[model samples]
Target chain A: MHKIALIFGHNDYTFEIEKNIKSHYKKIYIFNLDGQSVSKDSNGYEIEAFDLSEDWDELRDSVNIDECEAFCILEDMSKNIFLTLSLRETFKNLKIVALSQDKESTDKLILAGASKILPTTQTTANIIVEMLKKPMITEVLHNILYEKSNVKIAQIIVKNAQYFDGLFASDINWSKDYNITLLSVIDENGDTEFIYSAKAKHQQIKNGYQFVVVGFERDIIEFEKLIGGADE
Target chain B: MLKSLLLDAAYKINTSKNYTKTKHFFYNLLENSNYKYKKVFDFFMIALIFSSVFILIREVKSHVNDELLFYNNYVVSVIFLIEYLLRFWISGSITEVIIKQSEHDVMFGAEFNLSLALRDIFYQKIRYIISVKAIIDLLAILPFFHELRLLRLFILFRVFKLFRYAKSIQVFTSVVAAKKFEFLTLFIFASIVVFVSSVLIYVMEANNPASPINTLFEAVYWSVVTISTVGYGDITPITEAGRVVAIFVIIAGIAVFSFTTSLIVTAFTEKLDEIKDTKLIDDIAKKREFYLICGYENISKEVAKKLVQNSEVIILEEDEQKAIQAKKDGFFALHYDPGSIESYRKLRINIETQVKAILCLSHSDVENVYTALTVRSFNKDVFILSILKAKANRNKLLFAGVNELLYEKELVGMIAKEFVGKPVAFEAIHALRSNYNGIDMQEIIINERIIESFKAVADLECHKHRIILLGIYKKNKRNFYFNPTYDTSLEVGDYLLLIGNMQFIKEFTDNLHKGK
Candidate 1:
């Protein structure tokens, strides 16, 4: 039930981050540096207008800066770095999370005394949002994230399997017969390739090859019994 | 002859079996006929209606021949009357099916009351006479009753009956029907504007010496003409009050006209989009052979370019701009999500039907797998060629039922590997892959008909066809013979890999089929 403070620049990424992590905190405060009005109740969070160019006395006096968790997500790198420096100077015990627009900004934010730095160059939130849009991906992610799933991703090595050698990747119906997803394979040369991929499609399954599979723990054990393990 | 024909018709109607057959025939003709029969009937009806209209138009002229007009009208009216009678006769009662039962059946025995049956027939006949189509048919024949001058106007309703026959008119009417409320609003607004303007003009110009609008009717006409921006100079308002009113009317006219026009345009464009979507789906379903290319990227574009020469290519691209560009490049492109099963359903993909092969060329391996899985679920036999970007998702895709897998990294690696040791070989491979304007390689399947006319590789007359016999793929043996000997006997199920000019290769393949 800790209070959190979000410092924003004029961009959608700040709003997105606020939306994603809003449920974890008890009281959330969003400060728009450009003096632009941010909707309070729309995102189920409290919003305030503040200018980064001003002194920190007013901000520190307005909010309980000593106990609050701060996040600097300004669109401008310099502005974000300055805000982090100002926040770090005012509240020595405050945990400051700053967003870096690039590699240089990442180094600068670290030097500016941010407790943690999140690099926005790769934009992981966009990837997550996009992945969540697909129903299958959402189910897989939901199982991995929220549910205590029995499914385990395991890499099994093939040994003394006469029926499987020289068989094409497409020839096997792993899901239908064995209830397992054959993810990829590692060859005798220790080079891993996707079985259905062009690189591994022509590669014959030798005795020392390993297959990375995803399935229930019981199914993997059963599959291991059918195709002899790499230890044997 | 006439008396004998009448007696034969009466005797046929009295016979139950013949009556049943006649009823069935008329029912088919009127309601549930086949495509050709329905088309013939519609055309005949449309032609009759138009000819009646033409006769009506001709009757308006002063120098028309009265005798010929009367004869034509009489003949057309009799044909219409006969059609109406047939339609009415076939409009049997609900109990007609029960009445058709054999007399041996106790429910409809020989002792069944004939008076009840007669009453049902009379009731059905009365219902038919009151029906819309029957009334139209009656009106069509009404012009023949020239004794009643008032009934002559009913013939004009035949033109409106044409609305039922034409599909475009039906669509138009439905669109109007859907937007009737909006149209009513506009009509009310326009009526108020016209009324107020007429009243204002009458007040302003009634006593003015220079005003030409004298009567209330003239004022109303002048107001309408001026507001519609079709002002006739004969009825100009010279007074200052009249000029101001004219200005306001003109501005209101422009606003209302543009508003109504935009409303209609919006409705029309929406209808057009609906029609285009339906037509595109219909076209895809009707095509006997076509390739469904998922993802309109660079690789798929190249694949489409190669296939477009000898086949139809339907592209489903998620990117709207790319799909539009693909369409501009002369490919049938649909801006739809490839991973969605709904889009595949819209394309009507079926086994051994419209689609020959599906190329899943999306950059994302997961997306390709999903598309392949959806398509394979619907059609098990269709050739699903997917490109694998990530090596990790390969087996999952294969398990998902992709038929052919093209490894992107492996292809690039192979080419790079060959570049060091065999530069000349690499160049030849590159040339073939590029598929430059002049020389092209095509794979032609040898069917039963082609095998009958086939001889040795030398007797194919490749030189005459401006083609070089590259190799032959033996189907049964599953082996490729590169540059076979002249005496190699051609067999059925052999794939002829020939390299030649694009035009000649097409001609040679076409001739090979024709020679069968």
Candidate 2:
């Protein structure tokens, strides 16, 4: 099981991230770079004060380093860059998700050895605003992203291709038969494309190709069984 | 009967298509800086001014051929004359003034006063004639009369016409003109000092034959030279009284010069922001369609960057620091209060027509609402989108003329709520929403062509295209049918929400366009 660590510095998003992912992780640690001393937040998560200059030995002692993912999201972009650099220097292979303010900083964080960079400026709010223009699309995205509805997005690796043999990837009416939207396909070579993309449409369905589908939990489960595969 | 017939004929001519088109053509050529063709005409005028001035300068040193002189004397002058007339014609509409006056008279049951109407038209033309630009334009044509020496000297005024073509020069002159009151006071003071000093110096040194200052004219010259600190030793004061007067004059000269310098400096400094704002507006107006974003906070900064790829995005920021930051970030930003009507009015943006949309993205809901109302009052039909910070103020923003709003906190919270035990799903959804890996949700509107091309949902063959048909947003019902059935017949005005790679969607749309 993967553990989660949130290192925050005067940012508002850390609490929201922690609140949403709390139940998923067996052990979750909250570290505050801005404050001195330790205290429990309103959510009862203990906040441990941290310094960028440190080697992060205390963090390693509490959580299994190999099974942990860290999020670096400081509102001050310069400080966030420094923290990411420090964390990368301490843990060479750790998965670090860093929040970037803009394009320049996104490149900087990537260079700083962040495993993943979540750009705050370019992606979220702006895309949300664009989606809001179409109220129906916004509702669909809202449900798929946040709401606890039965609808979900899953990636299934096909272990058996008997049902899809001798058929092009687009030949199956997955939505009509299985009540699931087959979004994309990842071949054994790890090439991914939209299922209806010209290149994907011409390719024949084969075993070991991963399919990304979106639908209700029941429909996804039934489709997974029919495809002789499980979630990847 | 003749009077009514003449009035009807005049009104018909005033509203005629050809007549208005001609007026609009000239108006764009002479007045509308935003008009695309205006630049070409301005360049032509500038080239003419340069060539005419060059010929006049050339003639001063050496003899020119009659052919060259003829073109300079007649061709350039004729063009200038035509331009002057066009400018005067467009300066104010005489027909509008007459129509408004007649309408007022009719409403009040007053007798139509032909004399009063003529007087109004006379004053209107006279106002345009007396303007500094008009005077310069009128004088620029005088050079055509090469036979008259006095008129030839007026050709130098043609160089001043450059101000009419170059906007920066106009801005500089307007900045100086803003301090007209201060300069007027200084001018009166300096004149009085010169009058007194010239008289005093003349009375003190004229009787001394040894002194060079003899006549009042010479005394006036001496006073001007001394007060201006030119200090030519030839106009020296031999008597002690004259020396003392000279000393006082020099000191007063320093005071006057310093005051004038400080006044001009202050005026430029005060008008600096206004000049920049005007330039920004002109730049955006040149583009013709732009998103006017209010506030320069993080949300606005991000939105502006994204929107700039597709259209021009201008940010109106009230805070000086934020405005500067926005400019540094490569955005066109005006350091003007977004909540004030004066800011929009001064910008002269035709919100009803040119602005694509207005986005109020300030952190404070109150500020956003105020900005929305200010923009809405300017044009009731402008699409205003605001970011609502507080959920409680949603109705407040809606009431203030926000056509649509994005509640960033609520949206973020929703996304955050889904991170538990569904990390992959959350990631997949976020990735798709952000168009990561080229997957996105696109809305296609069913119009007449689309309806005819695709008779039913089955005809789209969305599965064959590999795009996910999320649902149809029925236009008539204003309702969404999730996972619509294949047999659902297509209808005009409905929106189909599909999720797929942008390339695939483009292919789908292209095929639909081709009626394949």
Candidate 3:
């Protein structure tokens, strides 16, 4: 589980963000300026809380440095920088993930030693807009990727594949030879379709067949050499 | 005559494409330029793509039904046979296509000397990415022995297919790609969940009465269903003690889902409002000895892309982020943002000549605008481009005598619309009206050394290749214009801010510099 420190601008940002990221992380500490946003999670791991920005010297006196982990600056830019910078000076190993209102804020946050500058809201809408674009492709690709798989979805183009060109699936000894399973092909005209039969074994595949495959990394690399073509 | 010839060439490149040309060429060759043959070819290719999909669906069914497997194999094989025959019938030369990719005589170095015509056939140098997808297309058809083992497995690929069909999925995928480092950890976490849960369930319930949970497969199934909160209950444990352990498993399930969601959220949030996939060139006008500054970040990249491309951009950014972005794009940039008076003095402006523009592209537009104002007080002739973040502060920038002001949010939106548009526009624009996490602008340079000449620019065949010239800023002349015509001469020094078809970006770049 990823360790995340949730810093709030007030209480709301901390509360909402912690609720969202709570499920994904192993441990999350939600802290507002008031130092009391700790809520019971549905799971057993109770989110810890703290707020040093409110009473710097005193709060700094109370919190234990050794117990803390990476931080997520969910609050507004200023307090996010102040608390995060203070936190950084001591717990240098703590990953600082801060949110920025815009580019200027992103710069300030970076100088203050925040590891990543979150663009805050523009990307969210872009994602929505991106979704509205060619939704079918998105749907198909997501289903393919999100599924449980020890294997990665990859493609290999048949460049100058001499041995496998005319050979069909039944004909080419992939299991014995390449150790990569040939899955599909995309033609020169940008048409992608499934490989049908052993017949493809005898007749050579036309130019531009990008083979979809699943296999060990070593064989995939070898197949990529044959199909993905020269990077040039 | 030369001008007219150039114009004619431009027209030819713009009006036709290889796809269209090939279609026409085939029709003419068959001596059936009339309507009949055209329809036939279209239907044939369409059938191939569509039928493959059908075959895949049928094979999915065959996986569960043993008797149906025979028919699936037969039907699939027949389709492959027909596809092969049709390709041979259509293509003029089959051997040339396959053999042309990997034939290498021999290369002594790491870079394979695959360019020579007489290279060996076994290693036909694969030049196109389409070929990899071709193999995938083929694999999608050939019925594997998978269904005989597990039916739930088919849902896996079908889901991927759904995402593949949507535009949002493309954006989602890009956001994921941008944060691949972060996502990899999540993936590893997911893998551990599946692996550890399986072991845990097996160890905990091996002798239990409720669910034997003997096989690793059942453990995997139970884990997935439980984590997803589906709780199919087909393989539930009957033992009371096992129930206690199951609660912990369910909790793990919730954590996994929550974790995965945040990963997507983080990636999307970072990518929002970003003005990505465009190159900036100085605006075209009479040269006033402008200095081109090529680098940008929040201040550097944002402002450089916002200003006119035709001007001499003496890009200054000490940050490696900005410097690297500039170098990868082939635009000239100095490594420094002249924000401070000391930095300005350090520029060592010949003062007498050669420098007539000062663009303070730093993170804060306020700082940049002020820097411009500061620079102008000393050298009034220098045109300054400032990067200011707030729209409310436009007057302040103008008061600074900045020739132009680039608002990161606004510029990101405009650049985004130009590069990857239709579904997604300027992230800045989207964010103001929509629920965007943030907006940013990025660069997509037409790589150096792809085509021998600027012929690719004139050819207009790039769109097919999925690279678009959103705006062309002629570096030599210091002129930039939006959506340049097909004939726009693309010199080595020129930078094109383009929105590449994100999916094909890798393919396009792979073809840029011959691999070595």
Instruction: Give the per-residue lDDT of model 1 (tens digit) for A1-232.
Output: 3455444553455555554455545556777776766576465655667776667787677777665777777867898899989878777888777777556888999998998666543222222222222223323322322223555545567875585767865356555467665645667876655444466658777777777665677887999887776221
What is the alpha-carbon lDDT for the whole of candidate 3? 0.50
Ranking by lDDT: 2, 1, 3
Per residue, candidate 1 scores C-alpha lDDT tens digits across B166-279 of 767767776776788988998888788889988998899999877887888988898788767777777888899988988888898897788878888878887897768767
List-wise, what DockQ does each model earn? Answer: 0.01, 0.24, 0.01
Best by lDDT: 2
- Model 2, stretches more than 4 Å misplaced? A1-124, A132-179, A184-212, A215-232, B1-6, B143-146, B192-216, B231-256, B319-330, B408-413, B420-423, B438-516
Per-candidate TM-scores read 0.46, 0.71, 0.27
**CA lDDT of every candidate:** 0.67, 0.79, 0.50
Report clashes for each candidate as comma-separated counts: 2, 2, 151
In model 2, what are the clashing residue pairs, if there are any?
A: A196-B465, A196-B466
Name the lDDT value of residue A175 in candidate 3.
Answer: 36
- In model 1, the Cα lDDT at residue A50 comes to 77
User: Local error of candidate 2 at B81, Å?
Assistant: 2.3
Query: Could you give the interface RMSD of candidate 1 in angstroms?
Result: 19.9
Looking at model 2, residue B414 earns an lDDT score of: 46
Lowest lDDT block of 10, candidate 3 chain B: B277-286
For candidate 1, report its TM-score: 0.46
C-alpha positional error of residue A157 in candidate 2 after TM-score superposition, expressed in Å:
8.7
Give the runs in model 1 whose Cα sits over 4 Å from its true position: A1-232, B1-51, B62-152, B161-178, B190-259, B265-289, B309-311, B325-332, B344-354, B429-444, B447-472, B476-490, B498-516
Compose the digit string of candidate 3's lDDT tens values, residues A189-216: 5443333322333345655655655455
